[model samples]
Target: MAKTQVEYAVEGIVTRQMIEIGKKEGIDPQWVQKRVSEGRIVVPLNINRPCSVVGIGMGLTTKINASIGTSTDIADIDAEVEKAIAAEEAGADTLMELSVGGDLNKIRKEVLAAVSLPVGNVPLYQAFCEAKQKYGDPNKLDQEMLFDLIERQCEDGMSFMAIHCGINLYTIERLEKQGYRYGGLVSKGGASMVAWMKKN
Candidate 1:
C-alpha cells in the first residue's frame, strides 16, 4: 500500500483492503490482486483526500461526473456552491468546477471545502477570461498566466485538470483546413481561442 504498482507487484502479497473489498463485491480476491498489480486500475487516494471508498476503473461499474459552476453571465458563487452540494447528494462520483465567472478562486475553494469527493477543473477557462479582461486581447494571453492559474488551482486542492494541450498552433491549422461545421469546435477553450484568432 505504501508503494507504486510495480513495487506492489514485486512483493506478491495481496493487500488486505483489496481482499476485503473483493469479498464484499463477490469478486475473486486473486483477480483483484492481479488487476491491481497491473497498471489498468488506479486507486486514487490522495494523502489529503479524506474519502474512504476505493474506486475501481476499467471494467468496473459505470461512474458519472457532475459538472456545476457559474458562467460569465450568471456569476453567482452561492448558487454554484448549492448546485455542487446538490450534485454530490444526487450521487455524482466526482464534481467539476467549470466556473468561468465571478471569483474563480473563491468558488473553487468553497466547493472543495464543501465536498469530500474529488474536484476537477479547466484552468484555461479562467486564464482566457482573465486575459481578455486585463489585456483586451485573448490571444495576448501569456503562457505564464496559464501556468500561474494552474498552480493556483492545484494549491486550492483541485484533484484533476482538463487541459487542452493537444490543440496547439499546428492543430489550429489542421482544424482550419477541415473548415467549420454547425457547432464549430464545441470545446470552450477551442472556441475561445478561435474567437481570439479571428479578432487578432
Candidate 2:
C-alpha cells in the first residue's frame, strides 16, 4: 500500500500535487501540508490517475463536487463526457462518476480524459451492479466482491470513493440510545448499506 496524502504530509513532504493544489487555492504549501497531516483537510489522489489534486473539508474554500454519469436508461457516453467538461467549466472542484450503465471502463476513461478535476467513484455501485447481473439480485453481493471492486477502481485511477462502512450495529445502538430518528435521509449509499446488512 502506498502512503496516504496525510502520511506524506506528516513526513514533512509537500508533494507536487499538494503544491499545485496550494497554488490554485492561493494557500501556501506548508499550510496545506499541515492541514493534510492533521486530517483537517483531505486531498484524494490515486497514483493511477494523473491530475491536479485538491483538498476538501475544514479551512478551505468550499469545493463543489458534481456527480455526472450514465444510467441504465440514459447511458449516453458522449453526453456524459460533455457534462463532465461543463461541470469543470462551471467551476466544479471535483467529479464523481456514478455510472451504472454502458461500458463503464470506457466511460470512466472518457470522463477522466474530459475533465481535469479530482475524480471519485463508488466502487460498491459497480460491485453490486455486477453482482445483480451475475446473480439476478444485488442481495448476493459479498465482501470479496466489494473488495475486489475497490482494488480494481484504485488501479483504474479512482482518486477517492465513498466507502459504505460508517453504519454498523454500533451505529444502530447509538441511534437508539439518542432516540434519533432522522427519517427520510436521502443517502443512496447509506440506504445501500442498510439493505445489504439486512439481506446478509
* TM-score of each model, in listed order: 0.76, 0.89
Q: Write the per-residue lDDT of candidate 2 for residues 66-124, one digit (tens) a residue.
A: 99988889889999999999999998889999999888878888898887788998887
Best model number under TM-score: 2
Predicted structure 1, TM vs. truth:
0.76
For each candidate in the order shown, give its overall lDDT on alpha carbons: 0.73, 0.84
Best by lDDT: 2
Backbone clashes in each candidate structure, one number apiece?
0, 0
lDDT of predicted model 1: 0.73
**Clash-forming residue pairs, model 2:** none
Against the true structure, candidate 2 has what lDDT? 0.84
